[model samples]
Target: MTRTNASLIGFSAVALWSLLALFTVASAPVPPLQLSALTFAIGGVLGLVWLWVRGDLKALRAVPLKAYVFGTLGLFGYHFLYFTALRLAPPAEAGLICYMWPLLIVVFSGLLPGETLRKGHILGAMLAFLGAGLIVAGGLSGVSGAITGYAIAFVAALTWAGYSLGSRRMKAVPTAAVAVYCLATAILSGVAHLATEITVWPGSSLGWLAILGLGLGPVGLAFYTWDIGVKGGDIQLLGTASYAAPLLSTLVLVVAGLASASLSLALAAALITGGAVLAARAGRQA
Candidate 1:
Protein backbone atom coordinates (compact mmCIF):
# COMPACT_ATOMS: atom_id res chain seq x y z
CA MET A 1 0.00 0.00 0.00
CA THR A 2 0.98 3.58 -0.56
CA ARG A 3 2.15 5.73 2.36
CA THR A 4 -1.07 7.69 2.15
CA ASN A 5 -3.14 4.54 2.38
CA ALA A 6 -1.05 3.28 5.28
CA SER A 7 -1.51 6.56 7.12
CA LEU A 8 -5.24 6.43 6.54
CA ILE A 9 -5.36 2.95 8.00
CA GLY A 10 -3.43 4.24 11.00
CA PHE A 11 -5.87 7.12 11.45
CA SER A 12 -8.70 4.60 11.60
CA ALA A 13 -7.11 3.33 14.82
CA VAL A 14 -7.40 6.82 16.28
CA ALA A 15 -11.09 6.84 15.45
CA LEU A 16 -11.55 3.49 17.14
CA TRP A 17 -9.56 4.64 20.16
CA SER A 18 -11.95 7.56 20.59
CA LEU A 19 -14.40 5.12 22.12
CA LEU A 20 -11.78 3.62 24.47
CA ALA A 21 -12.69 5.57 27.58
CA LEU A 22 -16.39 5.01 27.09
CA PHE A 23 -16.14 1.25 26.63
CA THR A 24 -13.62 0.99 29.46
CA VAL A 25 -15.96 2.84 31.77
CA ALA A 26 -18.97 0.87 30.60
CA SER A 27 -17.08 -2.36 31.27
CA ALA A 28 -16.87 -1.19 34.83
CA PRO A 29 -16.42 -3.15 38.06
CA VAL A 30 -14.24 -5.50 36.04
CA PRO A 31 -10.80 -4.90 37.59
CA PRO A 32 -8.08 -3.49 35.35
CA LEU A 33 -5.88 -6.59 34.99
CA GLN A 34 -8.90 -8.89 34.63
CA LEU A 35 -10.41 -6.61 32.00
CA SER A 36 -7.08 -6.47 30.20
CA ALA A 37 -6.89 -10.25 30.13
CA LEU A 38 -10.42 -10.73 28.77
CA THR A 39 -10.31 -7.91 26.20
CA PHE A 40 -6.83 -8.78 24.98
CA ALA A 41 -7.72 -12.44 24.66
CA ILE A 42 -10.64 -11.46 22.46
CA GLY A 43 -8.37 -9.14 20.51
CA GLY A 44 -5.80 -11.87 20.13
CA VAL A 45 -8.42 -14.25 18.81
CA LEU A 46 -9.54 -11.65 16.32
CA GLY A 47 -5.99 -11.22 15.08
CA LEU A 48 -5.46 -14.96 14.76
CA VAL A 49 -8.68 -15.32 12.79
CA TRP A 50 -7.63 -12.57 10.39
CA LEU A 51 -4.22 -14.15 9.93
CA TRP A 52 -5.75 -17.53 9.24
CA VAL A 53 -8.08 -16.01 6.66
CA ARG A 54 -5.14 -14.26 4.95
CA GLY A 55 -2.90 -17.34 5.15
CA ASP A 56 -0.36 -15.27 7.08
CA LEU A 57 -0.31 -17.32 10.23
CA LYS A 58 3.11 -18.68 9.30
CA ALA A 59 4.60 -15.20 9.20
CA LEU A 60 4.61 -15.10 12.97
CA ARG A 61 7.22 -17.82 13.26
CA ALA A 62 10.02 -15.72 11.78
CA VAL A 63 9.52 -12.87 14.25
CA PRO A 64 12.34 -12.24 16.73
CA LEU A 65 11.97 -13.06 20.42
CA LYS A 66 12.90 -9.47 21.33
CA ALA A 67 10.10 -8.15 19.15
CA TYR A 68 7.63 -10.38 20.94
CA VAL A 69 8.89 -9.27 24.34
CA PHE A 70 8.83 -5.59 23.40
CA GLY A 71 5.40 -5.69 21.83
CA THR A 72 3.95 -7.64 24.76
CA LEU A 73 5.38 -5.27 27.32
CA GLY A 74 4.24 -2.22 25.41
CA LEU A 75 0.65 -3.39 24.93
CA PHE A 76 0.28 -4.85 28.40
CA GLY A 77 1.96 -2.01 30.26
CA TYR A 78 -0.01 0.79 28.59
CA HIS A 79 -3.46 -0.78 28.89
CA PHE A 80 -2.91 -1.96 32.47
CA LEU A 81 -1.89 1.50 33.56
CA TYR A 82 -4.66 3.17 31.55
CA PHE A 83 -7.41 0.95 32.93
CA THR A 84 -6.15 1.45 36.45
CA ALA A 85 -6.01 5.22 35.98
CA LEU A 86 -9.58 5.44 34.77
CA ARG A 87 -10.76 3.12 37.50
CA LEU A 88 -9.21 5.33 40.16
CA ALA A 89 -9.86 8.76 38.64
CA PRO A 90 -12.71 10.45 36.77
CA PRO A 91 -12.83 9.10 33.24
CA ALA A 92 -12.90 12.43 31.39
CA GLU A 93 -9.98 14.01 33.23
CA ALA A 94 -7.96 10.82 33.28
CA GLY A 95 -8.64 10.20 29.61
CA LEU A 96 -7.43 13.67 28.72
CA ILE A 97 -4.22 13.08 30.63
CA CYS A 98 -3.68 9.75 28.89
CA TYR A 99 -4.25 11.38 25.53
CA MET A 100 -0.86 13.02 26.03
CA TRP A 101 0.50 10.18 23.96
CA PRO A 102 -0.18 12.09 20.77
CA LEU A 103 1.89 15.07 21.79
CA LEU A 104 4.51 12.76 23.18
CA ILE A 105 4.59 10.90 19.87
CA VAL A 106 5.19 14.10 17.94
CA VAL A 107 7.92 15.23 20.29
CA PHE A 108 9.57 11.85 20.59
CA SER A 109 9.59 11.32 16.85
CA GLY A 110 12.14 14.10 16.73
CA LEU A 111 14.61 11.73 18.34
CA LEU A 112 14.38 9.35 15.41
CA PRO A 113 17.07 9.36 12.77
CA GLY A 114 16.53 11.83 9.89
CA GLU A 115 13.99 13.78 11.98
CA THR A 116 14.77 17.34 13.09
CA LEU A 117 13.65 18.87 16.34
CA ARG A 118 12.68 22.39 15.46
CA LYS A 119 12.01 25.25 17.85
CA GLY A 120 8.38 25.09 16.87
CA HIS A 121 8.28 21.49 18.07
CA ILE A 122 9.57 22.46 21.48
CA LEU A 123 7.17 25.40 21.69
CA GLY A 124 4.27 23.19 20.69
CA ALA A 125 5.20 20.60 23.29
CA MET A 126 5.24 23.26 25.97
CA LEU A 127 1.79 24.42 24.91
CA ALA A 128 0.44 20.89 24.92
CA PHE A 129 1.94 20.26 28.36
CA LEU A 130 0.24 23.38 29.63
CA GLY A 131 -3.01 21.88 28.40
CA ALA A 132 -2.32 18.77 30.43
CA GLY A 133 -1.58 20.99 33.39
CA LEU A 134 -5.01 22.49 32.96
CA ILE A 135 -6.46 19.01 33.25
CA VAL A 136 -4.47 18.35 36.42
CA ALA A 137 -5.25 21.78 37.85
CA GLY A 138 -8.94 21.27 37.27
CA GLY A 139 -8.76 18.26 39.53
CA LEU A 140 -6.72 19.98 42.23
CA SER A 141 -9.70 20.22 44.53
CA GLY A 142 -9.64 16.44 44.69
CA VAL A 143 -5.91 16.02 44.10
CA SER A 144 -5.45 14.10 47.28
CA GLY A 145 -7.71 11.42 45.91
CA ALA A 146 -6.85 11.39 42.21
CA ILE A 147 -3.14 12.21 42.16
CA THR A 148 -1.97 8.63 41.76
CA GLY A 149 -4.31 8.02 38.87
CA TYR A 150 -3.16 11.19 37.14
CA ALA A 151 0.48 10.16 37.58
CA ILE A 152 -0.24 6.72 36.22
CA ALA A 153 -2.07 8.21 33.25
CA PHE A 154 0.96 10.38 32.53
CA VAL A 155 3.21 7.32 32.61
CA ALA A 156 0.78 5.44 30.39
CA ALA A 157 1.11 8.24 27.86
CA LEU A 158 4.86 7.88 27.99
CA THR A 159 4.63 4.12 27.58
CA TRP A 160 2.48 4.32 24.46
CA ALA A 161 4.63 7.02 22.89
CA GLY A 162 7.70 4.93 23.48
CA TYR A 163 5.97 1.90 22.01
CA SER A 164 4.89 3.72 18.86
CA LEU A 165 8.35 5.13 18.26
CA GLY A 166 9.98 1.81 19.03
CA SER A 167 7.70 0.17 16.48
CA ARG A 168 8.99 2.59 13.87
CA ARG A 169 12.50 1.33 14.57
CA MET A 170 11.40 -2.28 14.06
CA LYS A 171 9.88 -1.72 10.66
CA ALA A 172 11.01 -5.11 9.43
CA VAL A 173 8.88 -6.89 12.01
CA PRO A 174 5.72 -8.18 10.37
CA THR A 175 2.48 -6.57 11.50
CA ALA A 176 1.10 -10.05 12.07
CA ALA A 177 3.49 -10.37 14.98
CA VAL A 178 1.17 -8.13 16.96
CA ALA A 179 -1.19 -11.09 17.21
CA VAL A 180 1.39 -12.92 19.25
CA TYR A 181 1.94 -9.80 21.28
CA CYS A 182 -1.76 -9.57 22.06
CA LEU A 183 -1.92 -13.17 23.19
CA ALA A 184 1.18 -12.77 25.30
CA THR A 185 -0.27 -9.65 26.87
CA ALA A 186 -3.44 -11.55 27.63
CA ILE A 187 -1.50 -14.29 29.35
CA LEU A 188 0.57 -11.85 31.34
CA SER A 189 -2.51 -9.96 32.38
CA GLY A 190 -4.25 -13.16 33.34
CA VAL A 191 -1.39 -14.24 35.54
CA ALA A 192 -1.26 -10.86 37.22
CA HIS A 193 -5.02 -10.82 37.69
CA LEU A 194 -5.10 -14.29 39.12
CA ALA A 195 -2.36 -13.39 41.54
CA THR A 196 -3.74 -10.05 42.67
CA GLU A 197 -7.24 -9.26 41.46
CA ILE A 198 -10.47 -11.03 42.28
CA THR A 199 -12.45 -12.26 39.29
CA VAL A 200 -15.32 -9.89 38.49
CA TRP A 201 -17.25 -10.77 35.38
CA PRO A 202 -19.55 -8.33 33.64
CA GLY A 203 -22.79 -8.05 35.60
CA SER A 204 -25.08 -7.33 32.66
CA SER A 205 -25.42 -7.90 28.93
CA LEU A 206 -24.61 -4.24 28.27
CA GLY A 207 -21.37 -4.60 30.19
CA TRP A 208 -20.45 -7.68 28.25
CA LEU A 209 -21.20 -5.88 25.01
CA ALA A 210 -18.92 -3.07 26.08
CA ILE A 211 -16.07 -5.51 26.57
CA LEU A 212 -16.76 -7.00 23.13
CA GLY A 213 -16.73 -3.56 21.56
CA LEU A 214 -13.36 -2.80 23.14
CA GLY A 215 -11.89 -6.12 22.07
CA LEU A 216 -13.10 -5.78 18.51
CA GLY A 217 -12.30 -2.14 17.97
CA PRO A 218 -9.79 -0.22 20.05
CA VAL A 219 -7.76 -3.05 21.56
CA GLY A 220 -8.01 -5.44 18.62
CA LEU A 221 -7.82 -3.88 15.19
CA ALA A 222 -6.32 -0.63 16.35
CA PHE A 223 -3.00 -2.24 17.26
CA TYR A 224 -2.73 -4.05 13.95
CA THR A 225 -3.49 -0.95 11.93
CA TRP A 226 -1.17 1.14 14.06
CA ASP A 227 1.70 -1.28 13.53
CA ILE A 228 1.28 -1.00 9.77
CA GLY A 229 1.05 2.77 9.88
CA VAL A 230 4.07 3.54 12.01
CA LYS A 231 6.22 1.15 10.01
CA GLY A 232 5.25 2.42 6.55
CA GLY A 233 3.31 5.66 6.79
CA ASP A 234 4.05 9.28 7.72
CA ILE A 235 4.63 8.99 11.44
CA GLN A 236 4.58 12.75 12.08
CA LEU A 237 1.28 13.19 10.28
CA LEU A 238 -0.24 10.31 12.21
CA GLY A 239 0.97 11.86 15.44
CA THR A 240 -0.64 15.19 14.60
CA ALA A 241 -3.87 13.49 13.55
CA SER A 242 -3.95 11.61 16.83
CA TYR A 243 -4.83 14.71 18.84
CA ALA A 244 -8.32 14.41 17.44
CA ALA A 245 -8.81 11.26 19.52
CA PRO A 246 -9.11 13.13 22.84
CA LEU A 247 -11.70 15.54 21.47
CA LEU A 248 -13.68 12.72 19.91
CA SER A 249 -13.30 10.59 23.02
CA THR A 250 -14.44 13.33 25.36
CA LEU A 251 -17.40 14.02 23.10
CA VAL A 252 -18.34 10.36 23.10
CA LEU A 253 -18.26 10.25 26.89
CA VAL A 254 -20.45 13.33 27.10
CA VAL A 255 -22.96 12.03 24.58
CA ALA A 256 -23.19 8.75 26.44
CA GLY A 257 -23.65 10.63 29.72
CA LEU A 258 -20.61 8.92 31.17
CA ALA A 259 -18.85 12.24 31.70
CA SER A 260 -20.09 15.77 32.09
CA ALA A 261 -18.86 18.46 29.72
CA SER A 262 -16.57 21.04 31.19
CA LEU A 263 -14.88 24.29 30.11
CA SER A 264 -11.44 22.98 31.14
CA LEU A 265 -11.85 20.00 28.81
CA ALA A 266 -12.80 22.30 25.93
CA LEU A 267 -9.79 24.51 26.50
CA ALA A 268 -7.46 21.55 26.91
CA ALA A 269 -8.73 20.07 23.66
CA ALA A 270 -8.08 23.29 21.81
CA LEU A 271 -4.56 23.62 23.16
CA ILE A 272 -3.70 20.02 22.40
CA THR A 273 -5.15 20.20 18.88
CA GLY A 274 -3.55 23.55 18.12
CA GLY A 275 -0.22 22.42 19.54
CA ALA A 276 -0.24 19.33 17.36
CA VAL A 277 -1.05 21.43 14.30
CA LEU A 278 1.81 23.77 15.08
CA ALA A 279 4.18 20.86 15.55
CA ALA A 280 3.05 19.32 12.28
CA ARG A 281 3.66 22.57 10.46
CA ALA A 282 7.14 22.68 11.88
CA GLY A 283 7.78 19.12 10.75
CA ARG A 284 6.60 19.99 7.24
CA GLN A 285 8.90 23.02 7.10
CA ALA A 286 11.85 20.86 8.12
Candidate 2:
Protein backbone atom coordinates (compact mmCIF):
# COMPACT_ATOMS: atom_id res chain seq x y z
CA MET A 1 0.00 0.00 0.00
CA THR A 2 1.10 3.56 -0.58
CA ARG A 3 2.03 5.42 2.59
CA THR A 4 -0.94 7.77 2.37
CA ASN A 5 -3.35 4.89 1.88
CA ALA A 6 -1.78 3.01 4.76
CA SER A 7 -2.10 6.06 7.02
CA LEU A 8 -5.78 6.44 6.10
CA ILE A 9 -6.42 2.78 6.81
CA GLY A 10 -4.67 3.15 10.13
CA PHE A 11 -6.68 6.21 11.08
CA SER A 12 -9.90 4.43 10.11
CA ALA A 13 -9.05 1.60 12.46
CA VAL A 14 -8.57 4.01 15.32
CA ALA A 15 -11.94 5.55 14.49
CA LEU A 16 -13.58 2.16 14.57
CA TRP A 17 -11.82 1.32 17.80
CA SER A 18 -13.22 4.46 19.35
CA LEU A 19 -16.73 3.06 19.02
CA LEU A 20 -15.84 0.44 21.62
CA ALA A 21 -16.65 2.72 24.51
CA LEU A 22 -20.00 3.70 23.08
CA PHE A 23 -20.96 0.08 22.54
CA THR A 24 -19.87 -0.87 26.03
CA VAL A 25 -21.97 1.88 27.48
CA ALA A 26 -24.95 0.65 25.48
CA SER A 27 -24.43 -2.98 26.45
CA ALA A 28 -26.11 -2.58 29.81
CA PRO A 29 -26.07 -6.08 31.30
CA VAL A 30 -22.64 -7.07 30.05
CA PRO A 31 -19.85 -6.83 32.58
CA PRO A 32 -16.87 -4.91 31.22
CA LEU A 33 -14.27 -7.55 32.11
CA GLN A 34 -16.36 -10.41 30.81
CA LEU A 35 -17.11 -8.60 27.58
CA SER A 36 -13.48 -7.63 27.08
CA ALA A 37 -12.23 -11.15 27.76
CA LEU A 38 -14.71 -12.64 25.34
CA THR A 39 -14.12 -9.99 22.69
CA PHE A 40 -10.35 -10.61 22.67
CA ALA A 41 -10.83 -14.39 22.69
CA ILE A 42 -12.86 -14.16 19.54
CA GLY A 43 -10.80 -11.32 18.07
CA GLY A 44 -7.55 -13.33 18.11
CA VAL A 45 -8.95 -16.08 15.94
CA LEU A 46 -10.28 -13.48 13.56
CA GLY A 47 -6.89 -11.81 13.40
CA LEU A 48 -5.17 -15.03 12.36
CA VAL A 49 -7.74 -15.72 9.66
CA TRP A 50 -7.45 -12.19 8.32
CA LEU A 51 -3.69 -12.39 8.01
CA TRP A 52 -3.97 -15.70 6.22
CA VAL A 53 -6.33 -14.23 3.65
CA ARG A 54 -4.10 -11.18 3.18
CA GLY A 55 -1.07 -13.39 2.45
CA ASP A 56 0.55 -12.14 5.61
CA LEU A 57 1.24 -15.61 7.03
CA LYS A 58 4.94 -15.05 6.48
CA ALA A 59 4.63 -12.24 8.99
CA LEU A 60 3.81 -14.68 11.73
CA ARG A 61 6.93 -16.71 10.99
CA ALA A 62 9.39 -13.83 10.61
CA VAL A 63 8.70 -12.05 13.91
CA PRO A 64 11.37 -12.10 16.60
CA LEU A 65 10.84 -13.85 19.94
CA LYS A 66 11.45 -10.65 21.83
CA ALA A 67 8.96 -8.80 19.62
CA TYR A 68 6.32 -11.38 20.44
CA VAL A 69 6.94 -11.04 24.18
CA PHE A 70 6.97 -7.26 24.17
CA GLY A 71 3.91 -7.23 21.91
CA THR A 72 2.08 -9.31 24.48
CA LEU A 73 3.11 -6.93 27.23
CA GLY A 74 1.60 -4.03 25.30
CA LEU A 75 -1.52 -5.76 24.08
CA PHE A 76 -2.64 -7.32 27.34
CA GLY A 77 -1.49 -4.49 29.57
CA TYR A 78 -3.43 -1.95 27.46
CA HIS A 79 -6.74 -3.74 26.86
CA PHE A 80 -6.98 -5.16 30.38
CA LEU A 81 -6.25 -1.84 31.99
CA TYR A 82 -8.61 0.15 29.75
CA PHE A 83 -11.51 -2.21 30.33
CA THR A 84 -10.85 -2.29 34.06
CA ALA A 85 -10.91 1.49 33.99
CA LEU A 86 -14.40 1.36 32.49
CA ARG A 87 -15.55 -0.72 35.44
CA LEU A 88 -14.53 2.11 37.74
CA ALA A 89 -15.25 5.32 35.83
CA PRO A 90 -17.64 6.74 33.29
CA PRO A 91 -16.65 6.15 29.67
CA ALA A 92 -16.30 9.79 28.69
CA GLU A 93 -13.97 10.62 31.56
CA ALA A 94 -11.71 7.62 30.96
CA GLY A 95 -11.73 8.19 27.23
CA LEU A 96 -10.79 11.84 27.29
CA ILE A 97 -7.99 11.23 29.75
CA CYS A 98 -6.74 8.15 27.90
CA TYR A 99 -6.52 10.20 24.71
CA MET A 100 -3.40 11.72 26.23
CA TRP A 101 -1.35 8.99 24.51
CA PRO A 102 0.12 11.63 22.17
CA LEU A 103 1.49 13.62 25.06
CA LEU A 104 2.87 10.46 26.63
CA ILE A 105 4.51 9.46 23.35
CA VAL A 106 6.16 12.86 23.16
CA VAL A 107 7.83 11.87 26.39
CA PHE A 108 8.49 8.27 25.29
CA SER A 109 9.94 9.16 21.90
CA GLY A 110 12.62 11.14 23.73
CA LEU A 111 14.03 7.74 24.70
CA LEU A 112 14.24 6.62 21.06
CA PRO A 113 17.35 7.26 18.94
CA GLY A 114 16.94 10.07 16.36
CA GLU A 115 13.64 11.19 17.93
CA THR A 116 13.59 14.27 20.12
CA LEU A 117 11.39 17.08 21.33
CA ARG A 118 10.77 20.20 19.27
CA LYS A 119 8.87 23.41 19.90
CA GLY A 120 5.71 21.96 18.38
CA HIS A 121 5.93 18.92 20.63
CA ILE A 122 6.12 21.00 23.78
CA LEU A 123 3.27 23.35 22.84
CA GLY A 124 0.94 20.80 21.30
CA ALA A 125 1.40 18.27 24.09
CA MET A 126 0.72 20.85 26.76
CA LEU A 127 -2.41 22.02 24.95
CA ALA A 128 -3.64 18.45 24.55
CA PHE A 129 -3.02 17.42 28.17
CA LEU A 130 -4.46 20.56 29.66
CA GLY A 131 -7.55 20.05 27.52
CA ALA A 132 -7.77 16.42 28.56
CA GLY A 133 -7.35 17.39 32.19
CA LEU A 134 -10.22 19.82 31.89
CA ILE A 135 -12.36 17.07 30.45
CA VAL A 136 -11.67 14.77 33.39
CA ALA A 137 -12.32 17.61 35.78
CA GLY A 138 -15.61 18.54 34.17
CA GLY A 139 -19.18 17.98 35.37
CA LEU A 140 -18.65 14.28 36.03
CA SER A 141 -16.85 14.71 39.34
CA GLY A 142 -19.73 13.43 41.43
CA VAL A 143 -19.09 9.88 40.35
CA SER A 144 -16.49 8.35 42.66
CA GLY A 145 -15.67 5.66 40.14
CA ALA A 146 -14.52 8.31 37.69
CA ILE A 147 -11.28 8.90 39.60
CA THR A 148 -10.22 5.25 39.63
CA GLY A 149 -11.39 4.63 36.08
CA TYR A 150 -9.49 7.60 34.69
CA ALA A 151 -6.37 6.47 36.54
CA ILE A 152 -6.51 2.98 35.06
CA ALA A 153 -7.20 4.37 31.62
CA PHE A 154 -4.21 6.69 31.93
CA VAL A 155 -2.05 3.67 32.75
CA ALA A 156 -3.45 2.03 29.65
CA ALA A 157 -2.31 4.99 27.52
CA LEU A 158 1.17 4.82 29.04
CA THR A 159 1.42 1.07 28.40
CA TRP A 160 0.25 1.50 24.83
CA ALA A 161 3.07 4.01 24.28
CA GLY A 162 5.42 1.28 25.50
CA TYR A 163 3.88 -1.12 23.02
CA SER A 164 4.22 1.37 20.17
CA LEU A 165 7.89 1.97 20.98
CA GLY A 166 8.62 -1.74 21.31
CA SER A 167 6.83 -2.42 18.06
CA ARG A 168 9.00 0.06 16.12
CA ARG A 169 11.90 -2.41 16.41
CA MET A 170 10.17 -5.41 14.82
CA LYS A 171 11.14 -4.71 11.21
CA ALA A 172 11.43 -8.41 10.38
CA VAL A 173 7.73 -9.02 11.08
CA PRO A 174 4.70 -7.95 9.10
CA THR A 175 2.41 -5.65 11.01
CA ALA A 176 -0.25 -8.35 10.71
CA ALA A 177 1.84 -10.90 12.54
CA VAL A 178 2.65 -8.56 15.38
CA ALA A 179 -1.02 -7.70 15.77
CA VAL A 180 -2.04 -11.37 15.97
CA TYR A 181 0.72 -12.12 18.46
CA CYS A 182 -0.32 -9.14 20.55
CA LEU A 183 -3.96 -10.14 20.36
CA ALA A 184 -3.17 -13.71 21.38
CA THR A 185 -2.00 -12.44 24.76
CA ALA A 186 -5.63 -11.84 25.63
CA ILE A 187 -6.07 -15.61 25.93
CA LEU A 188 -4.47 -15.44 29.35
CA SER A 189 -7.06 -12.92 30.44
CA GLY A 190 -9.85 -15.01 28.92
CA VAL A 191 -8.62 -18.10 30.73
CA ALA A 192 -8.55 -16.20 34.00
CA HIS A 193 -12.25 -15.45 33.48
CA LEU A 194 -13.14 -19.05 32.64
CA ALA A 195 -11.15 -20.54 35.51
CA THR A 196 -12.67 -18.22 38.05
CA GLU A 197 -16.26 -17.64 36.93
CA ILE A 198 -18.72 -18.42 34.18
CA THR A 199 -18.72 -15.70 31.52
CA VAL A 200 -21.77 -16.46 29.46
CA TRP A 201 -23.78 -13.41 28.47
CA PRO A 202 -27.52 -13.21 28.00
CA GLY A 203 -27.95 -11.94 24.49
CA SER A 204 -30.32 -11.68 21.59
CA SER A 205 -29.14 -11.62 17.96
CA LEU A 206 -28.35 -7.92 18.04
CA GLY A 207 -26.36 -8.20 21.25
CA TRP A 208 -24.22 -10.98 19.87
CA LEU A 209 -23.72 -8.97 16.69
CA ALA A 210 -22.45 -6.05 18.70
CA ILE A 211 -19.91 -8.28 20.39
CA LEU A 212 -18.84 -9.56 16.99
CA GLY A 213 -18.32 -6.02 15.76
CA LEU A 214 -16.19 -5.31 18.80
CA GLY A 215 -14.03 -8.29 17.94
CA LEU A 216 -13.79 -7.48 14.26
CA GLY A 217 -13.64 -3.71 14.17
CA PRO A 218 -11.91 -2.67 17.37
CA VAL A 219 -9.92 -5.69 18.45
CA GLY A 220 -8.76 -7.37 15.27
CA LEU A 221 -8.73 -5.03 12.26
CA ALA A 222 -8.44 -1.80 14.15
CA PHE A 223 -5.41 -2.84 16.18
CA TYR A 224 -3.69 -4.37 13.18
CA THR A 225 -4.19 -1.16 11.25
CA TRP A 226 -2.96 0.98 14.14
CA ASP A 227 0.31 -0.93 14.18
CA ILE A 228 0.54 -0.15 10.50
CA GLY A 229 -0.14 3.54 11.05
CA VAL A 230 2.44 3.78 13.83
CA LYS A 231 4.95 2.12 11.56
CA GLY A 232 4.06 4.42 8.66
CA GLY A 233 4.63 7.67 10.51
CA ASP A 234 6.37 8.97 13.58
CA ILE A 235 4.91 7.41 16.74
CA GLN A 236 4.00 10.79 18.23
CA LEU A 237 2.06 11.87 15.16
CA LEU A 238 0.17 8.60 15.10
CA GLY A 239 -0.73 9.00 18.76
CA THR A 240 -1.88 12.58 18.38
CA ALA A 241 -3.87 11.82 15.25
CA SER A 242 -5.61 9.14 17.33
CA TYR A 243 -7.26 11.78 19.46
CA ALA A 244 -9.62 12.30 16.53
CA ALA A 245 -11.27 8.97 17.31
CA PRO A 246 -12.68 10.28 20.56
CA LEU A 247 -14.01 13.33 18.80
CA LEU A 248 -16.00 10.93 16.65
CA SER A 249 -17.04 9.10 19.82
CA THR A 250 -18.22 12.29 21.45
CA LEU A 251 -20.54 12.91 18.51
CA VAL A 252 -21.92 9.40 18.85
CA LEU A 253 -22.63 9.86 22.54
CA VAL A 254 -24.37 13.15 21.92
CA VAL A 255 -26.69 11.52 19.47
CA ALA A 256 -27.34 8.69 21.91
CA GLY A 257 -28.26 11.07 24.73
CA LEU A 258 -25.48 9.82 26.98
CA ALA A 259 -23.74 13.17 26.52
CA SER A 260 -24.78 16.72 25.82
CA ALA A 261 -23.41 18.74 22.94
CA SER A 262 -22.00 21.11 25.45
CA LEU A 263 -19.06 23.47 25.81
CA SER A 264 -16.69 20.91 27.33
CA LEU A 265 -17.02 18.57 24.41
CA ALA A 266 -16.41 21.42 21.98
CA LEU A 267 -13.31 22.48 23.89
CA ALA A 268 -12.05 18.91 23.75
CA ALA A 269 -12.67 18.85 20.00
CA ALA A 270 -10.60 22.00 19.50
CA LEU A 271 -7.67 20.96 21.70
CA ILE A 272 -7.46 17.50 20.22
CA THR A 273 -7.82 18.83 16.68
CA GLY A 274 -5.18 21.48 17.20
CA GLY A 275 -2.78 19.00 18.79
CA ALA A 276 -3.08 16.57 15.90
CA VAL A 277 -2.52 19.34 13.36
CA LEU A 278 0.58 20.53 15.17
CA ALA A 279 1.95 17.03 15.45
CA ALA A 280 1.45 16.42 11.74
CA ARG A 281 3.23 19.64 10.84
CA ALA A 282 6.10 18.68 13.10
CA GLY A 283 6.34 15.32 11.35
CA ARG A 284 6.51 17.03 7.96
CA GLN A 285 9.24 19.38 9.16
CA ALA A 286 11.28 16.51 10.54
Report lDDT (CA) for all predictions: 0.85, 0.70
What is candidate 2's lDDT per residue for 178-267, written digit by digit as tens?
Answer: 555645666667765676556667467667777777877776677778778766656666666766666676677778787778788789
- The best candidate in terms of lDDT: 1
TM-score of each prediction = 0.87, 0.85
The 10 consecutive residues of candidate 2 with the worst lDDT sum are 136-145
In model 2, the clashing pairs are none
Taking the tens digit of each residue's C-alpha lDDT, what string does model 1 give over 40-143? Answer: 99999999999999999999989999999999999999988887898788776787788788778877888898778787776776676666556545655544
Among all candidates shown, the one with the greatest TM-score? 1
